[model samples]
Target: MKVYLDNVGERRLIGRADVPSEAGPVWIVRLFGSALIIKEHYTIGTVTHVPDGGARPLMERAVLLARGQPPELLPGWQALAP
Candidate 1:
């Protein structure tokens, strides 16, 4: 899946991480330049531009938590897991 980060003027390709699933399935999305980490749970999403470097981990966790769920869609777009 590809995500566009308009703020950074770049596009991010999202895919599954190439690791064993003893932990569980995970979904990953990456964007270059001015990296900002965002996590969404339920209806609310949060964004963190700090340099703590926790975005990837948080996204993986979100995927695990959302396993077996249907995709989410807004008015004009849909969010599908990869």
Candidate 2:
């Protein structure tokens, strides 16, 4: 899925990820221009642990956005265009 930094003056195209259909809440946290995106993955009949305040981690990706890139978004979450 196409990701973006939404706290800046102009929206910045950060990066993307391959989130599954059963992916739950997508949590993103940023600091000093760096960000960590955590996607909850699960199946229809499967169970998974949630990312708690103090835990190892779940399936996630760390994206470092460029400080000079312009903000843009794709047409859809699973789209390749930007």
Candidate 3:
């Protein structure tokens, strides 16, 4: 599945990764320096910091989280608006 990041102005392709074995579908969102992994219909939102110098991994994690897997926590990646 493809997950799109809404940067307000334009959507960006953050990363692409295979979905988790159990997770059916999910949506992952990253803004500022926080990452949020959400199920398609779930409402609660949790924000966590990404690690330093971890752009690629964070992107991959975002993709995985979008696919319903637990996000791989990276503490310092920043999301810039388009």
Candidate 4:
């Protein structure tokens, strides 16, 4: 995931004060090896200020949550359903 993506669907570095509203039409996931997926996409984003392992591990936790697995959510987070 590009942490610096601008809100207009472009990949450019933005300041920390600038909030990002959009993520990607393509995402690069690296579980064992890196692979790019162009079909599935994320249109909106929510920011997480996890300073421990950064975004990757947080994303992994999200996967577990999706699969009804353990390792509950961190504080300041709520599971919302669409």
Candidate 5:
């Protein structure tokens, strides 16, 4: 799933990471610009953004919606993940 955060002029390309689990799959997100590694651990409900060069982390609470349910977005239209 790709998430476009137009409010901040950023885009993220996400894919499932290789892990064994029945709860929820871990996701690997690549943020545009800068070498920031973002990982979403669904079981913990947290999104961690760690920037390179020893910068501070930017974390946020994330909600995982079920398949076929799209995440809320702003006025601009967004493509629903399939």
Candidate 6:
């Protein structure tokens, strides 16, 4: 999944991802082979990854939270961005 900062600099879920029913620290499982466990005190408008697989196996992953507006493409393809 990809994350981006909205106009007000709030962390907004973008790309192919889902938000939990209750906010705060939580782990999210995607349809494919990627996941993220957000922390309670994590910055709202930023991208983060669980460094060493606290909830899943270790894998090389990178996420680019939007600095402004999200890209105008369909889901599942945003990860290809640098």
- Tens-place lDDT digits, model 4, residues 3-60: 3343333433222221132433322222333345322222234343346755543321
lDDT of model 3, residue 78? 35
Model 2 lDDT-worst window of ten: 39-48
Task: Report the lDDT of model 6 for residue 3.
Answer: 41
**Per-prediction TM-score to the true structure, in the order listed:** 0.20, 0.25, 0.23, 0.18, 0.27, 0.24
* Superior by TM-score: candidate 5 or candidate 6: 5
lDDT string for model 1 (17-57, tens) is: 22233423333332345445543322122232434755543
Query: Each candidate: what lDDT?
Result: 0.29, 0.36, 0.35, 0.28, 0.37, 0.36
Please identify which of the two predictions, 3 or 5, would achieve the higher lDDT against the true structure.
5
Q: Give the alpha carbon lDDT tens digit for every residue of 1-82 in model 2.
A: 4444534434344555443444445323232343444322211122223577877655433222335333232222332356
For candidate 6, the TM-score is: 0.24
Residue 80 displacement (Å), model 3: 16
Compared with the true structure, what per-residue lDDT tens digits does model 6 show for residues 1-82? Answer: 3444344544444443233324334332233343344222212223444565576443322233435433433234343333
What does the lDDT come to for candidate 3? 0.35
Model 4 per-residue lDDT at 5:
40
lDDT by residue (1-82, candidate 5, tens digit) is: 2232222324343333222333234333333465465432222134568899889998744333334323332112244456
RMSD of every prediction: 16.2, 14.7, 13.8, 14.9, 15.3, 15.6
The runs of at least 3 residues in candidate 4 whose Cα sits more than 4 Å from the true structure, single-residue gaps closed, are 1-22, 34-78
Candidate 5, lDDT over the whole model: 0.37
What is the TM-score of candidate 5? 0.27
**Considering every candidate listed, which one attains the maximal TM-score?**
5
lDDT of 3 by residue, 1-82 (tens): 2233444434444433334424434433443443445223311222234578875333232332233322233223333335
Against the correct fold, how does model 4 do in TM-score? Answer: 0.18
Candidate 4: C-alpha lDDT: 0.28
